[model samples]
Target: MSLTQEQKDAFKAIFIETVTNFAQQVGQATEKVFLQILPLTVVAGTEYLKSYEEDLKTKLEDCKTKSQKIIGALSTVKEPEKVEKTGDKHLPLGELLGKRVQRGEDWKWDDQDGGIGSFGKVVGVKGNGWVKVQWESSRNENRYRWGVDKAYDVKVVEIVDDLGDIPPLEEQIKKPTSWVIGKSVVRGRDWKWKDQDGGEGQIGEVIDVCDEGWVEVKWKNGTVCQYRWGGENAFDLKVVPKPKE
Candidate 1:
């Protein structure tokens, strides 16, 4: 079967064209299949991711609910009752009522001086965590009240069976007396001037004694002002006995 050179060339050209056409047809078919499956693949992947996200969301919600339940349980659980230590013994808050307490025994509130070293008997206990104390210095109608925590924390008061007896209201509070004008006096303890010029231990003269326990004083620095005698000023004035002329 020997063929001429021209015939051999024609056969080679036809074989090359047929192979190229077959490769082009195969490539087009593969491209068509990929285009048809791409949308479905994307949709399936999206659905899978959505399901995973929803599962994670559900888990997070469950965790949150469980945390809330745990917190609620902790909040509802009653705390163990604590026994407060006083001196050598431990006592509860209920036993503190009717106890005798002294002022300045321990730190209470900043403004409260623990009754200023005076004794007090617990008269009543309030549900709002306050104990009513009848101070020895206070009148019958007047009572000092303190928080339950402070009453327990401060070693000022102790449980006492006997408080002796309460004095009459009239005896507790002294009667008002007239102040002699031009009387020399020294500023008492914790005395502060309104203008902050003079203070405790400063010398002054009583110019007048007004109603409502207010006393007008002319200080050595020539500052004249009125102050509440036994109130916030707490001015303890010691009268200087006038020397014989």
Candidate 2:
């Protein structure tokens, strides 16, 4: 199921919060370790406890990796400007979103050669020139990353999106294209639920729980559903279409 914007935003927010908290906790834990009085001892003691610590570190690394993935997935637009420009000053998001996005193309106009440079497929494109074309970075890899090089300036040219790498706007967002609902209730931070059908259910994890009567959920099965949060838990039946494979 495609995720709703509310659900997506909530999820992104949680992941960001978790990553931030983990970093802080790790810093504090490291500081504590340094403050230890192991002046003349080995690096560790209680082999079992040492093993546990190792496992904890491994888990922490895994969480960090997952968090990184979340960041990479969610950060697609540039940070929002105070106001969207109506004219040629800048393109409103509606003009850019769902626009023809190619997978292996590039455009390099305003060049030293004084010509338009559009090449390959889009790979990815933001507004008119802001894009990530099918070009490889100095460091080549078979993986996608949240390119932070979109905020840069090049000589003889106006600007560049951090070397053709950019993240989504921290403010402006794409509307959700899909969702779900049914005779079950989801609640709490985890947004878990007990389906009245005598089955365990969850809206997935809580996306943004808005002050409004809406709670978004992106379920484990990759379904995004939102419910008006009020009254009784179970409401009319709502079904969601399976996402295209």
Candidate 3:
């Protein structure tokens, strides 16, 4: 009699559990045997376990061959699509939108270089091969063209999957409005300044609040510096309750 869908699912679960337990038991037994065999091989000399070793090696090879065949029959996995590292020729313009990118070695314009390791986000796509990018370091917008000297100069570092949650390029860099003195604040979730001052979760007092979105904070670890909190920069701080005075 053919099994119902529910019965089939129950059987599959039981089969998986049984196989998992069997694998664990086999692994434990094999480990114990290996431990015993190691001492025996050392104390009794290599020749003592030579015959059994050869037999085990033959069995292992047989198991590997059978496993390969089983895997080939069951698995429909194909080799992953290889990306060419030679140039950005493989990168399409459609894939680059809302992506954070860095300049590659092939970038020729020395005067327009956005520092060595600075990264930027693609905000707009221009005609020809040019793309508009909002740079993190400069907090300025710049346009870069692709396929310079046969190879594209842009190297994508990150892709912003959900564009709906993010604001426009112009809105992101504008000066923040909300800033008051003596407020307790912590670094935002997307805070990138891990090496500078105290890292994430380090609470500090907002010593000086600026209209330009930068706030001067005195960290608990005696670090006093200005950081971007809101507006044109990434929201770098979140207000927390004042400590029990």
Candidate 4:
């Protein structure tokens, strides 16, 4: 006779409970035997007890294996039911919208070449998990779709009060002929000095400017190097105006 759904469920539950209880009782019995043998410590008593314990442990492991097999068998006894959705229903995009993000919030792209450390700002978040961000290094705005299109590629790192106060990359890299020795400057994104590894946003002072336009900069860390002052490397160095003392 075929059993009803409720009857089948009750039978399966009872079977699992019974087997689990039996396994627990066997485990407890094994532990009791080990405890009872703990007191004997004569010459050969130790060796004998150790051998018996090993044998007992092997039996317990076999029991555990059998219990696991019983549980595995239960899976074949019943098939899982699948629920079908009828309407044009969709899961809500929660926590992916403005909740965790806001305008002018700094972010870093989680990509190769250490984009994770590169700073950017959120321009806006479109409804369906799309967020527009303006990168600090490139100064370019790009749209990223969260969850679906690796929106997690970029993570919000900081929030600024005013983005407008930040100067453009072009203006920051402009070479001023009036720059004199001992003037402070910052390493721009285009700055790629070998051996020194001068990272982006590193502040330094101009130690000397050669006739060929190669400027020797003394970084805040005391490391000095002569970096090229023209082409791609030219924009790599930015002149920083000294703050009022």
- Write one digit per residue (lDDT tens) for candidate 2, span 128-186: 23433222222111111112233211111122222123223221112121111111223
Give per-model CA RMSD: 25.5, 24.4, 20.0, 23.4
lDDT of each residue in 1-245, candidate 3, tens digit only: 99999999998887556656755777765455556555764877767688789999999999999999999965754323334566443465545655677886567656354688887666555334566666767656667765432445667776534432434434433423222234566766457777565676777865544446676777889988777766464676665656655
- Over the full model, what C-alpha lDDT does candidate 3 score relative to the true structure? 0.61
**Which of 3 and 4 is the better model by TM-score?**
3
Q: State the lDDT of candidate 4 residue by residue for 1-245, as single tens digits.
A: 89999999998887556656755777755445445434633646878989999999999999999999998975554322222334211112322221222222123434421253565544444454555555555645566544433224454433333222435557544533213234456765566564363565667765544444566677767797776666434655665554444
Question: Which wins on TM-score, candidate 1 or candidate 3?
Answer: 3
Candidate 3: misplaced stretches above 4 Å?
1-89, 111-113, 161-245
Please give the lDDT score at residue 214 for candidate 2: 53
lDDT for each residue of candidate 1 in 143-236, tens digit (9 for 90 to 100)? 3334433434233456543223323333322422122234455654455544443765556655555445565667768887775555453544
Regarding lDDT, does 1 or 3 come out ahead?
A: 3
Residue pairs in candidate 4 whose N, alpha carbon or C atoms collide under 3 angstroms: 191-236
Sort every candidate by lDDT, greatest first. 3, 1, 4, 2
In candidate 4, stretches whose alpha carbon ends up further than 4 angstroms from where it belongs are 1-169, 172-177, 194-200, 231-233, 243-245
- What are the lDDT scores of the predictions, listed in order? 0.52, 0.36, 0.61, 0.51
| Sequence-dependent TM-score of model 1 | 0.26
Q: TM-score of each candidate?
A: 0.26, 0.20, 0.31, 0.26
Q: Over 4 Å off in model 2, which ranges?
A: 1-79, 82-89, 97-116, 119-245
